[model samples]
Target: MTSPDQPNPEAVSDETLFGADVADYARYRPGLPDAAIHLLAATQHGVPDPVLLDLGTGTGQVPRALLPVLRRLVHIDLVDVHQHMLEAARAALEPVRGSCTVSAFTGEAHTFTPAMPGLAPTLITSCRSFHWMSRPRVLAMADRVAAPHAVVAIMGDGSLWTHEADWTATLRRLIQTYLGDDRRAGTRGTYAGPGRPYEDDLADSAFSDVSEHCFPVARAWTPEDVLGYLRTTSFARPALFADRYREFEAEALGLLKAHARGGVLKEDAEFTVLLARRPGGAA
Candidate 1:
């Protein structure tokens, strides 16, 4: 639904830009976060030797997975606007000892550049983080730093409900149990809260012009995993709420118990990969 001309409002905040739920995020969503390594495996050559750059690289996940494959993963510059996230990435990457050149910096996606000084990257990868970028600016930036024959791969949750079919019902029961007094507001609304909404591409813009593909990845969780996943979510943070999260967690757990089959919640979800190349850049 987003257009090239409209700036996605969600691009502005630093939700977990700080180191808030980084550990939880790394735990539950480890699969998707680590999926960037495989992205390079899908290159035209079927195995890539391209110079890489990772935008919004959280906890150094991409670099950790990719360093082994590339001939020389030179000048890996990870840019994140959050200082805390960068700190976590630094810590995670510090133990790495190899020929790869790794560096972390604090900057927005648009301001990020390869560390190789005037070099354009042959491959660029972003995972589950582009929904927060300004569409027009990002596409223009991609067109700039991406080498003539470069490839960019972007992954996102095309449909969060792709897995959790009955989240609404679960949510309803949870609200009824936790907020016993006023069930309506707690269930239908305020789960994700106002500005922090969970959906995809409010505007269908130039970036959507790329060749797109989707595949189902792992999306199974017990009540505990679900709780861990929520802790990593932008919505589940204490700063975003007026009330203590215990009430919210109790309500959420109630919903899961009410709708869960055999006390477990399963959802059909997949990862969407959008691979684009500059028209004349590569064959």
Candidate 2:
């Protein structure tokens, strides 16, 4: 392990950050809580024909969750830096696409523009992903392509690393034992989160009119589920462990089992959604 004075490892290029974890991610990462999903649909109410631009759309969770309830949604554009993620997103959303057009773009969210120009979206979303982007640049792009009444919804509940429970605390300690004390991030670096809250970022951006919502969610996990979720995390993914990932997995499973109560581990999470709109009386 590097000394405290040592610099953090250089991060992998953003495009490749989550590429290797797609399968486990698709299989195990929790979807947006249903309350949040319904609220997102309501955000588009009264719009003539709503369309969606889901930035950093990991496996298209935002769209997949909204499609069933947001029936009038006419189109969806899924953008991500990783093509692997976009591919999996496409597969997951196809059966539910209905008459709406679903398109995937493999590129940075800040640089994405519609293949069909002049088609502004009524709803824009980024879930658990805005931090991985050039935040100001993305909001600027969203400004150029959004309908005046469109809402930019940034949503996330903190991951397992932030969850506070006796079991999760134990799990974090075990992870630190294998990795390091500083949070491991992506493939090559430690996580240094945004300096200020996302609220501060929005306050300075085009979408200065903002509101926040929180949905309390309760989730239960099995030891196997915990292992599968760990495989998709930047901190504990198999690559981070090198040759010892199998050992880590075995040990992690045992540790989790010992902590489980009646075959379950619990998470009490609050999912937060920040809805931003242009600073005007459009709505």
Candidate 1 wrongly placed segments (more than 4 Å): 1-18, 33-39, 44-49, 95-97, 158-164, 172-209, 261-263
User: What's the lDDT for all of these models?
Assistant: 0.57, 0.84
lDDT of 2 by residue, 109-210 (tens): 888778645558989999998888889999999989988888999999988998988998998999999888989996559988877899988999889999
User: Which stretches of candidate 2 lie above 4 Å from their native place?
Assistant: 1-16
lDDT of 1 by residue, 176-235 (tens): 454342322211233322243222231232233356667766555677677676566543
Which pairs clash in model 2?
Answer: none
Q: Worst lDDT window (10 residues) for model 2?
A: 1-10
